[model samples]
Target: MSKRPINQLSLFTPGLDTDPAVKATMREAARSCALSREQLCDRMNELAGQAGIRLNGGNAKQLTLATLEKWLNPLDREHIPSARAIGVFCRAVGSVEPLQTLVAPHGLYLIDEQQVRKLRMAEIEEEMEALKREKQRLKAGS
Candidate 1:
């Protein structure tokens, strides 16, 4: 398979608005790593449109990292993505250099489905505890 450029793929990343710092980091990664900007933009435009992300609002030529936090993540925002996210955005998901340069530096810790499951379980546990506490308080009052 022919390798697509970095700039092309990075643009499609969901947080065109949410994660600007990461976006700026991605742009720098593209330039330093020699990724294609135009192709990335094209792919980004296509995917973002499907996901209902506005493409033509702010910072036209470049993505602004600061504005990223305002919008909701396309899917789930709680846990950061793992290989799945990389598979969706990166040209090389498993490559060490890519992870070190493109993802890790930006504080995006990749989490697998197992990690997500654990987090969900933890959240459930917390909710259960809260409910139990509320029940105890009601019993005491009664």
Candidate 2:
């Protein structure tokens, strides 16, 4: 019932603050990227191959081409080729922005990326502590 793939969300999204112009810009960038979902997946697969990294199916969810490149070929910087290819693809498609750069500052910074995961884990710990306290209170009441 949707126009796009079932698993895919539209690449174009409104800006964080919900400005129409920003959303327009994002849509423009996604269009410029010039890659379909399948192509992006293959690009990632190719990079993984070059790094000689064997990715298990389960781990694939956690693995991204940029992340894998940063981890596996940190010193060599060979993975840059992949980024450049994507940039060129974007340019050819009339995309004015380096969509990667646009999105990275917002989505994939060292602090923000790590903080959200840490916060979720902290929440889990807090729930466990509350449960433990509740159990003690019940046992004392009896």
Candidate 3:
């Protein structure tokens, strides 16, 4: 029997827009994250009202619908918002979806507050169990 080269197989198709797998994954992420375009816009608008952010060389206390529409439009990929803007949106909405979407392709994940709390609790429980076992072992040896 002869072995086939790995490169001979088709690993990935080039066009993401036309690829069913890519589309399905995107749709699934959006659904699981429960983030709609309207909700995103509303969150962005709410964040824009705060005193710190500046957009396009002007102090925008609030972002206008026109600006937000341009940013949110699927056809306007070239004009998509910056990473900082996405971060602000995530913080404003209390959701990690935007950050996860941005970093997923790079093999990264964004941990939320609830996940952190759970992880910490697990660690504490494990440590307590270990301490109890060690105490028992020392008493037996004595």
Candidate 4:
């Protein structure tokens, strides 16, 4: 007997197209972030409490170690938090490492405050230079 073809809608899920190498790197990063010396679970709990994030319909006090375990454990792919939750966690904890890890495989990086300031400064300098050139050109034309 022949099996029916799967629908296109079912063929594409978020992260389904991620490269294997990238996925492996992300997994390693997740493991590292979860097991860091700072204790990710405790940090998450503290951050969640501070930020008023309710997990699994539970109050801040209800956010348990097991919930964090499910989030951090790379093997528990089925229970990983959504991307938005990851971003919220990172911001609440004042650490972009987790977000950086998640996006590194996609050739992207989340710039820190210092990096952002530097980038903006460079952009402003470039704009100033362009304006200077334009001024010079107009003067020469006149």
- The prediction achieving the highest TM-score against the true structure is 4
Per-prediction TM-score, please? 0.33, 0.26, 0.52, 0.59
Best of the two (1, 2) by TM-score: 1
The predicted structure with the larger TM-score, 1 or 4, is 4
RMSD of each: 16.6, 15.4, 8.4, 9.5
Q: Candidate 2 — number of clashing residue pairs?
A: 0
Off by over 4 Å in 3: 1-46, 57-67, 91-94, 106-108
Better of 3 and 4 by lDDT: 4
Alpha-carbon error at 3 in model 4, in Å?
42
On residues 1-142, what C-alpha lDDT tens digit does candidate 1 reach at each position? 9775544434446543344343344444445534355555455445555655444454654222322222213333442323323233344222233344445433455576899999999999999999999999999999
- For residue 55, model 2's alpha carbon misses the true position, in angstroms, by 29
- Model 2, 1-142: lDDT tens digits are 8476443434564244322332344345544566654455465456556656544334553245454333223244332333434443344344535444435435432244588899899999999999999999999999
Tell me the deviation in Å of residue 115 in model 1. 0.5
Of candidate 4, the 10-residue stretch with the lowest lDDT total is 7-16
Q: Which residue pairs in candidate 3 collide?
A: none
lDDT of 4 by residue, 9-78 (tens): 2333335333333334434554555445246556655666677765444344444666655665655655
**What TM-score does structure 2 among the candidates reach?**
0.26
The lDDT-based order of candidates, best leading, equals: 4, 3, 2, 1
Which parts of model 4 have CA positions greater than 4 angstroms off? 1-39, 57-61, 83-94, 103-108
Q: Better model by TM-score, 2 or 3?
A: 3
Tens-digit lDDT track of model 3 for 12-109: 42332322332333334444555565675566666655636643335755555566555545555444555556556556556566556555444456
